[model samples]
Target: MSNKVTKFFGSPWGQRVSLLIIVILVMILFQPKFFSLDNVSSILLAIAIYGIMVCGMLFVVIIGGIDLSIASAAALGGSILSIFAKGSGYTVEGFITGFVVAIVVAILVGLIHGVMCTIFGLPAFVVTLATQYVLLGAVLVVTNGAYIYHSDFGVFYMLGNARPLGIPLPIIIFLIYTAISAFVLGCTTYGRSLYCIGGNPVASGLVGIKTKINTIIAYIFCSVSAFFGGMILVSMNMMAGAATASNAIGSVLTAIIVGGINLAGGEGGIPGAIFGALLVGIINNALILLGVPSDYQKFVQGVIIIGAIALNVYTSRRSENMKTPLKPSKKTLDSAQSAKL
Candidate 1:
């Protein structure tokens, strides 16, 4: 019984179970009322939006790339959507047109990153960092540092705020994307190749993998996902502002890290990413529920992110050590030699 218990606790799912239990205990002690259906739905709604962005980050990280431009790309996409929706006149046709244009802009940004990384042999970090600045500058230029409002698109607002059968659309969209991402990462050859490339680019290339193309595809996925996240943000707020969207960077990175994804890549999954986002969302909601001051929230978030990353590193190292071969006893070695003789 003890061995069984130990084995169970040693499993990944078991660790998750333990974490969930701890979370439940903390909530029960700190804010027992948070377990309500309404609160749960609200948390899900928040997670849905950020979770989508985290999913994109997961793709980038899995392919051993980082996208510093995701936040700005999202901002740009949302801004474009708002700009076109207002300037092209008010109609369903205009809304569709604007939405398509916004998505195209995001894809183009992603293509630039891909080309820069693959063709020019630029590091993804450098490429994305530069693109981040470009995107921020573009947003400022396009909107002239003003918020773009789309008061005419009432139906579009439903994408972010409306609930159908008590389920938020964003949450639905999140689940759909999560499902697709999980499938792609788990069941597809492309997904397997991402792991291979991240694990060892040289080996992957030697094995006939199109490493460059795969890396490019991964960045495109990240940018497109960020674009979708921006669309949701615009739909929710009914406005897009150049300066404000920058605030999401810390939270997005926190989610990706807390979800147990290594910054170095080749290890982590969508479930881990989702759990990380949920953990952050819950922590924030709990703070609000406890009536914590808004000014102190940033400090608390920073502390939590640090703690999560530290824990992830410790556990990952421990797991790696556990997988190493145990040293053979002298008696065992002698027995093996005698048997061979």
Candidate 2:
């Protein structure tokens, strides 16, 4: 039984199952109505939105990097999509074109981020931090301190409001993206390279892996994830503004951390992150049901983040300690004797 428990926890799928069980138990205990069809749909909706971002975020995090600018990128994407999607006219063809343009803008932002970090050899932390601010400024500039509201959402509204076959469309979209991301990460050479680079960039480079190229690609994907999530947010809310992605960075990080992805990277995958998003969404739902203030909710989330970080550090140290110790070469001893003589 002990071995079985350990083995079960060892795999990604097992971890997700365990998380799901825990979330279900918590919901049952605290919010009995959580199992109702309406409440279940709401939970799934939140998870779907977050899952979209995590699908993309998994790439960046697995490559031993972070993308702090995701929220800002999403805000800008949402704003652009709103303008193009419903601003002037609601023709289906025009909205589709505008949506494409907004997505392109997001990709361009990601490209710039990747170039600055990979090509210029800048620290990921510093680069992403700087880009976050820059993107924030861009979002503000785009919105001009105002929101673009669409009272009549036209066809674009279907993205958020549609529930085909009683399941939200966003959830379907999330599942599709999840399938693609999982396939890429689990079945492709690029995915292996990502793990290699994150595990040890220097070693990957020495072995002929294009670390810079992979890093660039990872960042681009991460930013694109932001855009996808942002567009969903706009569709869900029927509006876009500078605050479109507000608190998004924190929320996404929370999902990653709680989902068991190591912040240092090269560990975990899409499954874990998706489960983590679900767990976080559950927490959010519980909080809402309990009528907890937003400030207190933030504080609780902060505690969760700190706890996850501590766990990551502990596990990392334990792994390092478990490794075999290296022995010194004989040449080093000879050199020491010579120096003493």
Which structure among the candidates has the greatest TM-score?
2
Assess the local accuracy of residue 15 in candidate 2 as a C-alpha lDDT between 0 and 100.
Answer: 53
For candidate 2, the 10 contiguous residues with the lowest summed lDDT are 320-329
TM-scores of the models, in the order given: 0.87, 0.87
Error of 2 at 310 (Å): 2.7
User: Which residue pairs in candidate 2 have backbone atoms (N, alpha carbon, C) closer than 3 angstroms, thus clashing?
Assistant: none
lDDT of 2 at 203: 95
- The weakest ten consecutive residues by lDDT in model 1 span 243-252
Candidate 1 ranges with C-alpha deviation above 4 Å = 10-13, 293-298, 316-341
Tens digits of per-residue lDDT, candidate 1, 110-180, equal 88888898889899899999999999999899999888876764657777888888778899899999999
Residue pairs with backbone atoms closer than 3 Å in model 1 (clashes): none
Q: For each candidate, what is the lDDT?
A: 0.82, 0.83
